[model samples]
Target: MTAAQRGRRVLVLERANKVGKKILMSGGGRCNFTNHFVSAENFISANEHFCKAALSRYSQWDFIAMVERYGIPYEERKHSQLFCLSSAKDILNMLLDECSDAGVEIRSHCELTSVSALDHDNSRYQLKGHQNQTPLQLACQSLVVASGGLSIPTLGGSGIGYDIATQFGLAVTKKQAGLVPFMFSDASKALCERLSGLAVEVEVSCNNTLFRENLLFTHRGMSGPVMLQISNYWNPGDTLSINLLPDTDIIQWLQELKQQQPRSLLRSGINQKLSKSLTSELQALWWPEEADKPLAEFSDRRLSEIAQKLAAWQLKPSGTEGYRTAEVTRGGVDTAAISSKTMETKHQPGLYFIGEILDVTGWLGGFNFQWAWSSGYSAGLNV
Candidate 1:
């Protein structure tokens, strides 16, 4: 749409039956299109500064203005995440409306099988593909690869963008699942299964990165905003430190409760903040002997130990759920070989890479969508 708006003839070839499948499914069907506040700090990239230029040029406000121009109702959630008030289809319809107005042609189920330079200076290119079984060929001067990354194959995610980058001699980085759920195989797995469907607000930390959000217990593992956010910083064999009671100092609160309510059981006091089932599980794991004992019956040292355990419970995860459930891919084409300002490959003139196909992954929320808008706009102006 941006390219067409800039008076450049644009043709969008989509391998899926329709365009914006991911957009239609994001944010529980109400697309979290962009954030209220976005900076380079919100993204993870091999070159930390690679996304700054494009983001600055086409910020979140620019996208918001477009949303408002279409009169799409939106609402802001926690952490400044902006989501469509009705359905994700609204955003998709707005984009399609813009494309239609700009005279952009979209061809669905057209896969590009191969591409080659047509001239010595690489000014022109030949693209060969099949549009639903029929052979197709095209020639163009500028090519933009927005094929996206490998995450949720059902949503049209593919590695064709990375393959094209490597085919052109551009370095491709190691890719992994980001913003994915963690699966446990140890005793924690049983605990999680037993407590499946339970959600608690907590601060989960790994590799010195902390995220304070809701942690949800699943039959297979743990998920929700906190786990997904910290998974980006976690690696194999890393232990996660979870603070069940992050808003309150457990030690002081417990001590005061012990003095004020001598007959109250430890489980009873903890049950006030945590669910009864979770508190029971913790009591069995941390202090089985004090399950039926009153607060005054326990010594201060024992209470402190329980407090420490509650403050920092250690749990190691077997691994993530992988690309099957990941929100984004961690790495892709190395940003070192790409121009940050225009999103055009330095070594391959007229070839531009944007969005998740690059080594830029944003934090959970609407950061990733913002990168798509900014990078797409950058390449649109130059392509």
Candidate 2:
């Protein structure tokens, strides 16, 4: 929009039959467009400070203003994340309306099979591909590679972005699934299967990082906001420390429960705090020796041990579910190879990279979309 406002002709090429398929699916169709407090601290990148300039220049407030201008109703959710009150289609339509108003021509189903230098003497890019099975070729001076990253393949996520960066001699970093679920080994899978579909608010910690959100137990493994958030820092063989009871002081709470309900069975007493099924699972795992015993029968030392175990239960996941279920990818074109201020290639002129195509990956919620707006806005101002 900025480029068109500055009188530069703009054209957008979309490989999908429709633009913003992913956007339409974000936040359960009600798109989480931005967060109330978005900063460099909320993002992860190879060069940590690479996102400061663009994010500051085009903050969440700017995007909110656009949303308001379009009269798109929105609501604020947990963690200051904002979501559309109606549907994600509203945001997509607003963007399309803006592009149309600015005279930006959008050509959908224009997949570029190959992008290479037109000639050594000229600084133009020759794009070749078939649009609707018709021979398609184009030449342009300024090229913006916003092809996105590899995550959900059905959502048009692929490695084309990295391929383009490498083709242009730009450094592409190691990419991995971020905001994804974890899978357990065969031995541990049975536990998750038994607790499948059970969701509880808990703090899941790994690699000295902690996420206080809901952890959902799936038939295959674990998911939900907490697991997805911590997965960004998790690696193979890393053990996660989960605090099942974050709000209660387990030791003191256990003693009080035991004192108040001396004749009650440990399972029965615990069932009051947790679900009966979860309490059974915990008793089977933590206090198998005294699971059936009454609270009065348990010694102080034994109660302490159980409390300690519940407070910091450790588990090592076999691996993640991979990009098939990931929300966003971890890495992309190296930030060191791009100019932070303009999102332009330092070595290759007229070539800009933005959004998921870059190394910047935001946390769960609306951070990623905010990066898309910020980086895209930055590139627009310069390109």
Candidate 3:
């Protein structure tokens, strides 16, 4: 039987709102559709190789083709991030249109009340929901859970994915908000507040993983591309080291500064690269007593210490801004329970999970959306 003749009823459960709520708010309104370089190494999950199958099946080029087919103009930003020339609505329309063409029924404004499979007919599954005062029951041979993760609750992201996984004897990894802003220490918060709206190209590191991008100081804490990327690896009480001068070797550069202006004050010399307020903060931290002293008077050891401080300034974050401000959730349904090729539950047949519902979390740039399309498409094809 053909797909239509098979009468294969498929139900996709979306919360009362809509998909692409987060997409609309991402990248300053223009959605970063996908990234050029999407490797398994960039993703984080319990089973490392699990992402390889779906990613290979639906490559970045594949997503770009679909975007191009829709006549949506896109441009490559830094780090090969593809963004729509118009708005994020184009991408949403593409996904909805694909579902329509495939005869997949999407039920919005309907919350999933419960889901269970028939004990006798293992291939049969039932989904319960409500449209208004009347209840709705959807029965199908295949059931896919694409409810997403609990990141931005305002956008309708929920923990329903894990809850459903647990109902079916699936394991859920420890979940936390990823790609979020870092909340600073009291001292650091004050300093960040002083430097609010200041952004510089620098490197941010956490747990040995380094992100080279722009770090923006916000009124509440730290954000921007670099900080958001590194936020995945960061934990409370962990120090986030910042390399203010990532390209220029501070040690060698300081030596050059010594040769060029031997009698200049340390703060005056650093003023060339760092902001005046930031320079003052560093001077206060480095040389509170002799902050006004000339660079020529400093010994090699003191200069080395100062250079090291500038090269890698460490700050312990109090916590993250949490789901309210996070771009994605870090962990979810463990990958080991699902087949990498089809996203079907290994323990339970005819059951599938996709999108942010899985543990796999991508980097800041368009990678997560790529995972969504890839994993969603994988299950869509098989289901």
Candidate 4:
């Protein structure tokens, strides 16, 4: 759109028959296009400050204004994450409409095979690939690879972008699954399986980072916002400390409840604070050999131990669901080789890498899409 607006011919090569498959699937179809609040703090990148310039140049307010210009109704969700009030189609359509106005030619089902410099001076780029099942090639003064990262392979997420960076003699970083669920360790697998489908508001922490959000139990492992957020900072063999009852002082609550309901069974009193199913599972896991007795009969030390366990329950995850379910990848082309201001490689002029192809990975919100817009626009202005 920027190239065409500048009176330059523009072409958009898409590998899919449709242009916005991922956009349509984002935010459960509502499409969290951008966030009301965004800053360098929201992203994770090898060069930590690389995203600042582009983001500042094309801020979230810029995109929101554009959405408003197109009359697309949107709503602000949790943490200022903005979603289309109607559907993701609205955002996609707005993009398409802008491209149309700019006379941008969109060729769908275009798969790139190779890219090489046309001249020794790197005057132009030669792009050879198949377009709609037909062989095609291009010679352009500039090339922008926004091929995204390895996340949802079903949606065409792969290492193609990293492959391109490697082909260009640039450094690519180690990549891993990000914003993914955690698989349970052997010791916790059975309990997680038994409590599958149960959800609790929890504060989960790992590596000095913490997130308070919903924690969901799955047959395979643990998931939900809190788990997903903490997974980004977790490594293999790391144990996550979780507070199931983050809202209350568990020790005091239990002591008071025991004083008032001395005749109540331990499970029953705990059940008052948690679900019956969860209480039963906890009893089996924490005190399996012990008999279910009145709260008055249990020793203070036993209650203290139970309280401490609930306050800082520690569990190590086995692994993750991998790219199949991850929202984005952890690493990509090293930012040290690229220019933060223009999204262009310093070693290779006229060649740009934007969006998820870069090492910048945002939090699980609309931050990723915002990076795309900001970085793409930065390259567009320069290209």
Candidate 5:
């Protein structure tokens, strides 16, 4: 029934009016809650095993089972991303319903004033927030910090997750916005602006890591699936390489075209594999003068050089869109001090950290929400 009915105490503090605000907006309204391709390696954490324990305890199949229970029709898209037949609200309702079933009390619109441990043992916590008339005080045997990270502030993202950890003598890793769009500098901004609305399938590289997907050009900067994937690894002033032609051996393709059509324009030869707008933009960037040159006039060495340039077009991003537009936060509460099996703080008993608040962050797609499901279940079951 209610908290009073069950005689079990619980308090879930939600800063915004909407508890699952981000959950509603994710995956273009259909929540990609979890994926079939899940492993400890897919996540980044201070202690890799921290996620392994929880994830193994509550696997992707567990969430899928719950989804099946709700009878939410779903389909597997590319990369094993599962989308709801309707909207993300179904997933949110499922979670809320589960929490209710467990006799969990969700306190919405309640801004946490402060959190501190009660005694030397640090077994109990004191939580302060405004209630019906005045500031209210809450003492609990356990405190679970699932407040999330500082991404999409409009969606109730906050550092409140970190604050609780810090107050309890826990370590928090450096945080940053990730899986967000990249913005170019003023000089390069003009080119990106000029090519706005043009999207092409390409391979994007940031240092040793590379991602192959569709890249979109925006008036402000770069986005789309590929760019968003690479943005997680991109840092300020770091060089990024874009392969304009992903699958084609540009030189060989052009050589054959040159023999077939001796008077063909250089742009036309490249356009056979690439979009005309993208080909024009790349040709302007690579060989502006040769944009009008006949393919027959090009030598093998020149073609090879063009191929190299096309395969690797490097540019350094000035910065990213930051937490406001970030899909998920990069860092959070360090996992070293927390128990991997239980998600409980080692030093502070009954103190737990789960979801995006912890250091574990997953790649784009359904990974992050998977972390939430696994980690949340771990804490919920154990606590």
Candidate 6:
């Protein structure tokens, strides 16, 4: 749409049967289009400054203005995440409408077999592909690879973008799953399974990075905003330090409670801070021998031990859920070879890499979508 708006004929070849399949399924069908707050700090990249230029040029406010122009109703959720009020289809329709107005053509189910430079100057390019099982070929002045990363295969995620980057002699970084849930194989797995469907607001930390959000217990592992956010920095064998009661100093609170209610059971006092089921599980795991002990019966040293557990519960995950359920891929084409200002490849003229296909990965909110809009707009202006 941006390219077409610039008076350049634009053709979008989609490998899936439809365009924007990921958009349709994002944010529980009501797509989180962008965030109220976005900065380069919200993204992780080999080149930390690579996204700054494009993002500054086409910020979230720019996209919001377009959404408002279309009169699309939206609402801001937790962490300034902006989501469509009705459905994600509204955003898709708006883009499609823009494409229509700009005379952009979209061809679905077209898979590119190969791409090559047509001249020594590399000013022209040749693309060979099959559109819906029929052989198709085209020549163009510019080729923009917006193919997304490998996260959800059912959503049409593929590595073709990375493959193209490598084919062009651009360095590709090691890829891994980001914004994914942690799967445990030890006793933690049983605990999570037993507490499946429970959601608790907590601060989960890994590798010195902390995220204060809701942690959800799943039958297979743990998920929700907190786990997904911290997963970006977590690696295998790294133990996660979870603060079940982050806002309160557990030791101080417990000591005061013991003085005020000397006869109250420890579980009863702790239960006020967490779910009874969760408290029970913690009691069994951390202080099974003192389950029946009252506050007064527990020594200060023992109370401190329990307080430490509540303040910093440790859990080591065997691994993540992998790309099967990850929200995004962690790495891709190295940003060193891509022009941050125009998103065009420095080594390969007329070739641009944008969105998840690059080494940039945003935080769990709407940062990723903002990158897509910004990078796409930057490339569109120059492509």
How big is the positional error of residue 206 in model 3, measured in Å on the Cα after superposition?
Answer: 1.6
lDDT of all predictions, in order shown? 0.93, 0.89, 0.85, 0.88, 0.83, 0.93
TM-score of 3: 0.95
TM-score of 6: 0.98
For 1-383, candidate 1 gives per-residue lDDT tens digits of 88999898888889899999999999999999999999988999889999999999999999999999999999999999999999999999999999999999999999889998878443477899999999999888799999989999888899999989988999998898999999999999999999999999999998878999999999999999999999888888999999999999999999999999999999999999999999999999999977889999888899999999999999999999999899999999999999999999998889999999999999999999999999999999998
Position 377, candidate 2: lDDT: 94
Tell me the deviation in Å of residue 327 in model 2: 0.6
Clashes of 4: 0
lDDT per residue for candidate 4 within 314-380, as digits (tens), equals 8988899888999888889999989998888898878899998899999877999999999999988
| lDDT tens readout by residue for model 2, 1-383 | 77777777888888889889889999999999999999898998989999999999999999999999989999999999999999999999999888888999888877788988765434478888877788788777778989888899888888888988999999998888999999998666888999999999998888878889999999889999999999999888899999989999999988998899998888887777788888888888888888678899988999999988788988999999999999999989999989999998998888899999899999998999999999999999998
Cα misplacement distance, residue 62 of candidate 3 (Å): 1.1
Q: Which ten residues in a row have the lowest lDDT in candidate 3?
A: 1-10
- The list of candidate 1 runs beyond 4 A from truth reads 120-123
What is the per-residue lDDT of model 6 for residues 232-346, given as tens digits with 9 covering 90 to 100? Answer: 8988899999999999989999999999999999999988889999999999998898888888998999999999999899999999999999999998999999989999999
Worst 10 residues of 6 by lDDT: 116-125
In angstroms, the error of model 5 at 22 is: 1.1
In model 2, where is the ten-residue run with the lowest total lDDT? 117-126
Query: Residue 273 of model 2: what lDDT?
Result: 76
What C-alpha RMSD separates each model from the true structure? 1.3, 1.5, 2.2, 1.7, 2.4, 1.1
Clash pairs for candidate 5: none
lDDT at position 138, candidate 3: 73
- Shift in Å, residue 346, candidate 4: 0.5
Query: Which pairs clash inside model 4?
Result: none
Error of 1 at 380 (Å): 0.3
